[model samples]
Target: MTTLAIALGALVLYLIAYNTYGKWLGQKVFRLNKDHIAPSIELEDGNDYVPTKKGIVFGHHFTSIAGTGPIVGPALAVMWGWLPALLWVLFGSVFIGAVHDFGALVVSMRNQGKTVGDIAGNVITPRVRVLFLLILLIALSLVLAIFGLVIAVVFRLFPQSITPCLLQIPLAIVIGFFVHRKGFNILIPSVLSLGIMYLSVVFGNLGFLADSNATLAAWPVMTWVTLLLAYSFVASVLPVWVLLQPRDYINSLQLISTLALVVVGLVVASLFGGAPIDGLRPPLEIVAPAIEQNVTAKQLPLIFPFLFVTIACGAVSGFHCLVSSGTSSKQLKCETDARFVGYGSMLTEGFLAVLVILACVAGLGLGLNKGDEFLTGTAAWNAQYSDWASSKGLAAKINAFVTGSSNFLQSIGISATFAKALMGVFVASFAATTLDSACRLQRYVVQELAGCFIDFKHRKLAEPLKTEKSFQARKTSWLTNKHVCTITACLIAWWMASLPAIPGASGIFGQPGSGGVILWPLFGATNQLLGGLAFLVILFWMRRKNMPIWFISLPTFFMLILPAWAMLYQIFVAAIGSDQSWIEQGRWLLVGIGSATIILEIWMIVEALISWKNLQKTAIQQD
Candidate 1:
């Protein structure tokens, strides 16, 4: 009953927030007018900027932003205790995450769908623009590196998920062509795609397909990372309608369906418990303690800043800001869709996080069949999260969600093999959608960054250059090509994910590419810091418009202060100065990048402060 109450309460709370607080932000704060034209309409290029319907835009935006961030973050954070993670997710998503996403989307839409980084120049200062883009560049690079590794890990963990995920590509292309070229109704194709996707998941556990999946899963993580990055490059360079938009749209449909099923399964399990294993079914209850006890700082560390950082996407991830301002802002058909696409999608993700938390904490306690024995209650929860170290393993972290969620589905009479396949496919699909979206966003960031280095104009490049120095500058222009930028983002990420001698070896989810463990916390802090920086851009934008910003101001300060605290601690106290410092581990790469991120963040915040000071000074003079 406690588990049931938490699940139902989250759903109700999110809905109320959307109508009350979310509505207030839309109408009173940002003032989204339906009559206003969107950038997608103003600058329709048939490529990046197509005016998409609100529903399609919402689907794309939701899946792109949600990704595995919600799943993996909460799955790990629940070890700190479900109560803390739950509070941050519920409050942070409403007050901070949703608002940040909504504000960034609206600002970008109003700025001709420019990314938040690009808009920083007009709202704040040009120097801030470059600083913001550099942060975005580094952040997206982490995304590309980490998400590729995540999906590869997922594929390696659940091979049956592979074919179903793979099948979505051709299915998406077909839908893309018919809708864009043939002018067909979207309903038929959507149904057809959904049907095919589920069929793949259902049959994925049976007969020949299962064997084929095993063969595919056996491929090393590095090989899958390379191949996945290659796929991202292709998706990056293609027209949005051809791959990116359609894939996200349909992927959202299938994802939503699976989510609904999982919710139903959760409801059933909470009330009746799983179909009894060994003539016993434990009532669904959170087994992982209210606040973890007997845990050393070595096991879980201080939960203050780290918990906030750890539960990023579920609460307020910085990556969501990029997606909101980057891809989502562009596709919005009208100014009014900002609330639905931005705020609504984030709330949806928050709910997913809530589910993940329950799945890990409550769902695991219902029943876990381990070989010849069935474990329930505390034993079951411990199996999933005995200690932070075991739980942090790249494969262990994700498999926790998969295995736990499968238990929920299995509670509803779904077969064990099929439930595992479904959850596996669901997780992989999410990671894949985010991977593709990140690549596209990275290409945009790369292009914007590259444009800053134009020493030679295109008009004069072909003409005679008097000196060798003049010719050398022409090469920089070539780097701005869409293909080059896309490949550049993928290759760099590939290099990082391919780094050898990662900590874990053949663990529960096969030979681990332990980068996920190394990168997860680092990325969480970096990502949340980026979110805070984005809020700064939005705050500046609101101030310029003379819009009331009491709502935005607190979140801006919070997002900025907390992530910075975490990153500072991570660098000075943890990575550089701690007992198990990266220096000791010979991980100079992590140390170097982590240090650079902190430096960039401090620089940007200082710039914002100066701008604020000037704004106040000018106002005083006017008075």
Candidate 2:
């Protein structure tokens, strides 16, 4: 009862703190405007800077920021016990995650929506801009590919998830038609879709459609990989109205509903049911441990670098930084919106991390009373937890906590049964949405890189390629054409994503690590590294704008430095082979990527320095 009270109280306090405290800081320190016009006119005509509502923008920002990284990182952290993970969530958000997110959005907005890359070039250095873009491209591409594998792994294990997952297709198409073709309002379709989506969940639970397909009865890993990729392609190319908007609307509902369940479940279970476990220590010991009997000495004291590295997305994420500058900044209906979208949304994700870890702890406790054989199989254990939760009648409590302060899902009469079933559908749906977003984002990166290199070569070759064929073969001529470049880039991405589709394969394809491992880490580092670099730019820009350094530059500086140090430290561990852990191998691969990024960023910073100096000298001479 005490624990449940504390948990509920903590949640309410955090929400209040984030909304009130965070908002106050944003408004007072930054004086962020909720009404700034997005500088879409300043950029090229792409989907990058489209104006959007706060709710829709929140959906995009939330989905992009919350990926496989958070889930996997925190899930594995459970071995360390819930307390450490919970503390990390609580502390890390206020100091690290929220600042990075908030600062990035504000800086990007002030910079005419030029994106992190352009800001680096203009404020920091020309070389840094290009370097950051390359790193971002490689990092985001790996993210897309790795997350595809993550979705695949989950689906292969849970056959019941398929029918409900596929329900988004027709629902999205219908919503798309109303919004685009029928000129219908977003509110109506969103409301209607949520209702129907709930029904699908109920219908599936009743065995109406869920038990339909024998072929889908048990999907192999490859089938999952294929289906996930296929879904990504369709989702990415479709109108936002049809798929992205409605799907995200329901997801928003689920996110709120699940959060609500967590709170309510904690209260009811702790007070009424007396939480299944108390005084349960983390499975692993810091000393000569029973934790990793099969594990080694170097891997024992999982301290310093490992702890920070393990909590990647929740603490800080480069991907969120990209979304901040790339898409979210441009869509700000007001500058003040950054606080809500940036800090608020990140805190929300941080809260979700806490809730999920709590669920894992609670679920693990219930499993312990059952036996070891049950816990050995991760898939079965997860299923058992769901069943145990349902059996105990505490699922609704957990869902209430997950649903958030809005209780929007509960308002719609979404029952506990449907809410539990809706979780898988929502996870699969969001993953699918992110997969497509990543693909499109990757294509953009490839095209940009091609253009940059092509322009460089074009200048060099112009004198030599005076002949007809030579002129046509110039870099600009070859690479500037969007259609050709886009097709080539998409193919490259598709090929990378398809590697996991091979027969009986279990190794990473491109970035590093085993079983599609390197992708997430690389993405994590690349995203944060970009965030760091963007922070540097923001710091410089804030200084130039005469804004107080404390709120903006200080946060920017920390976001840049902490993760930069974390990545560097991990690289060192990997380089020395200090702990022969699987993560260490992944660490080494990310280190290489990180090293490449630092080199690129340093060079870019230098170029910006030279450019800045030249401009100053020229002005002085003119004076």
Residue 18 of candidate 2: its Cα lDDT?
Answer: 86
All candidates' TM-scores?
0.93, 0.76
Candidate 1 lDDT, 29-50, residue by residue in tens: 8889999988998999988898
Whole-model lDDT values for every prediction: 0.83, 0.57
Question: Model 1: runs farther than 4 Å from truth?
Answer: 279-281, 370-372, 455-476, 501-521, 575-579, 583-586, 621-623
In angstroms, give how far residue 207 of model 2 lies from its true place: 5.0
Clashes of each: 0, 40
User: After TM-score superposition, what is the CA distance of residue 301 in candidate 2 from its true location, in Å?
Assistant: 5.8
The reply for model 2, stretches above 4 Å from the true place, is: 40-49, 180-185, 205-208, 211-214, 217-223, 237-239, 274-301, 367-420, 454-489, 497-515, 518-524, 552-558, 561-578, 581-594, 601-623
